[model samples]
Target: MNNEKYTLITGASSGLGKEFAVQCAKMGRNIILIALPGGCTPSLAENLANTYNVDVRIFEFDLTDSQELKKQITLILERFEIDFLINNAGVGGTSLITETSMEKIDQIMQLNVRSTVLITHMLIPHLLQHERSYIMNISSMAAFSPIAYKTVYPASKAFISSFSLGLREELSGTGVSVSVVYPGPIMTNSNTAQRIISQGIKGKMGLLSTAEIASTAIIGTITKYPTIIPGFINKLNHFLMSILPMELKLKMISRAVKKELI
Candidate 1:
């Protein structure tokens, strides 16, 4: 086994994934950065490798393609000792259930859920052998709510949140740790702000920069926090949402969805 600890971040070519790659490198972690084929991150990988003076290996594949992911990851694990796995490759899709197509839902689930499950499943053995290991799944505040227009996206995040929590429990007795990041309106291309704004959602807020969110997530994962909700307001919102009655909460959320993003 390779002795050096490398951080493996998926979707690393841009947005939150790219930010994670840079921040992890700054912390002096060797990085296995995975980007979609032809995505922006390959060039960024070169920059990060030069600037941070950390070993950077780029893995390029379409995460939604199961065969491609398995082949690529198997090849990389032959040589890299991954200490951290960030299950962060995801896409956003927004449509009412009535308007959504099966094809779109499948695509979203394939990348956001199936791909995450498969990668983590494949890497668990390697992670188990590490003295200490961290797996961070990027969920969303939508995991706590049943979103309207953006129906399938929230469900995908909910899957991530539940999977991370269950995995955390399963790994409790071991050195491997699982962390879930529930970011609210991150200022990334895949975010609520765009869909909500375009739909005229009322009282919606601006989002955190990807760098800011990624920094917080990295800190939480490194510290082995079970869950990290990035912003103060988002944290408070989650706390309140947890206690609020479901009926009242759903009504309020439904109104907001119809008013803003629908």
Candidate 2:
């Protein structure tokens, strides 16, 4: 019997996903990095293997493609017994919903909602096989409210929040702890950085680096925290949102996000 376990992280090529891989490797856990076909996961796997001296593997598959996702994920389960799952691959942008093409909307829903749900669904049995296991879903602070330009994105993340909390209860006492992370604006890439910079102070509020977010998320997930809103400022933001009227929050958030279209 193999006693070794693997932490499987989607979007492991860069950003917060990359940070998750790094931090988990630092924790001496073997990793299985999943990313798109042209990703940097191969080199990352090599570096982590040498630097942390832990086993690292890479699986490249576009999660948005339901057919490919099914094939690849099934193969992954058959080959590796991954006890930790991180559903981190997601996409969003600031554009008017009318201007957003059907293709674009489908992509967001597929990658953000469908893929995450499918991957988590397929992996649950494998997860239950372990004496103890962890599942961390990366949601967003955007999930707390509605925004105009980035409509579908927030809705998808809200689903993740609902799904995570519900699954946590369902798997309660079963040793499979499900936790969701709500991260504020992350400077994960040049495009994202530009977008955040464009928003000035408002965007900067509750900001945390990928390393900080990953560290906090990992710690929370391991300790079985059902919901992780990293950073004090983020917690404050959550509090503020909780108290605000939905109608006003929507208008404010919509107005702020409308600037991104310019």
Candidate 3:
């Protein structure tokens, strides 16, 4: 709220987004936490502000709402300096293309792709003003290969990967470091955990804690790594996937994910 610089993280009420907020606050950085309204952000703000003794401000808004999203960002820019941005608000699902609802499809696109791009596009100017700044867009291991059941989600993540990397090059040597993190499966909740567990060892191959993902991603972003795969298995998987033929890679990944529908 003061003249302080903060890290703005979307979807900060829970899951990986919350973990990023926690780690950033722990690093003694002020924070601007954003999530949909009618959430626990107020309480999370209180906890972080108390525990870390830093300025933790919370803005509750649906990123899908364009007008309000812009309004909130304007207010934030007017009030505080933000040197770091975390585009963590995204959703993914596994199902048949026909089974996916129009609303769900729109939400995924808006949150994962549009909102991320909008947030970054807006904050880049503010970030560049600082002597050093950072941007971290959360992609996924799924981004490396297109899976059958997760058609839209992976494509969206792939966009994030490409966008972040391209923007990193465009901003080369500007001291405004941009990075994309490809995190493996994160057991954010019981349902997600059950789904991953049901798939056995194959599902858990690159699984990492939300804390690990958040911490490692922050470290990589600060160190200016343009592409960060959080776990060793994910890195290896990325490499292995690179060697496979496109058709075979698509078929193999599709076959494995098709099991989720059963």
Candidate 4:
């Protein structure tokens, strides 16, 4: 059996995903980067290879398509022995459910939930081939409570958090660890940074840089942490929500989101 190991990252083209790739490369790990077509992944892959001097392979396709995603996975497993699977690709929006189109809802569910599950399910066998393996799923703080303008997105992330924890228990003593990362807000780009700034205190409360979150998540996963929540404020927020009644938690989040929306 081939002993070569790799870290496979979804949505590796930009944002937190890109930072995760960079951090992994710095650790001298081989990478299999996947992103939607027509992005900067080609150039990013080239740079990582040149700078890190590690094997970096790039695959560009819409992960929302299950059939195409499966095909890509088959192709990936044929070439590399994956040791880490990072399900970081996701989409989100803020809008009233009544105003949100069905198409938009479907897209969020497909990418954030369906594709995550499909890829993880398909990669479990390959991940087990390695002596030690890790799976890191990117959830959000939104998963802890439901907000007014965001519904489906949070629900989808809730699924990720639950799924990762359950899978971790199931994979215990099997040399494979599953970790879920619940980041509050990531300054992924200039636009996101500006938006967060505009939101004032609420946005800055648990906000974290992409690099910080990525590095922490990678290290936590390697150490076999079941749930990784970056930033002290985020951890505190999670603790508070965990103890609150569902109705009160929802009310608090809704008020906070209302402030931002207005």
- What are the candidates' C-alpha RMSDs? 2.5, 1.5, 1.4, 2.0
Better of 1 and 2 by TM-score: 2
Best model per lDDT: 2
Model 4 local distance difference test score: 0.89
lDDT of each: 0.84, 0.92, 0.90, 0.89
Query: Tens-digit lDDT track for model 1 on 15-86?
Result: 889889889888888899888778776688789888888888888888888999999989988988887999
Q: How does residue 33 of candidate 2 score in lDDT?
A: 91
Q: Give per-candidate clash totals.
A: 7, 0, 0, 0
Candidate 2: where is the Cα deviation over 4 Å?
1-3
Cα lDDT, model 1, residue 110: 97
Q: For residue 109, what is the lDDT in candidate 1?
A: 94
Candidates ranked by lDDT: 2, 3, 4, 1
How well is each residue in 78-184 modelled by candidate 3, as lDDT tens digits? Answer: 99898999999899878899989999999999989998988888888988899999999999988988888899999999999999999999999897999999999
Model 4 over residues 146-222: C-alpha lDDT tens digits?
77888898999999999999999999989899999999887777756765676679779988888999988999999
TM-score for each model: 0.92, 0.97, 0.97, 0.95
Off by over 4 Å in 1: 1-3, 190-193, 196-206, 259-262
What is residue 133's positional error in candidate 2, in angstroms? 0.3
lDDT of 2 by residue, 26-96 (tens): 99999989899887889999999999988898889888989998999899899888999999999999898
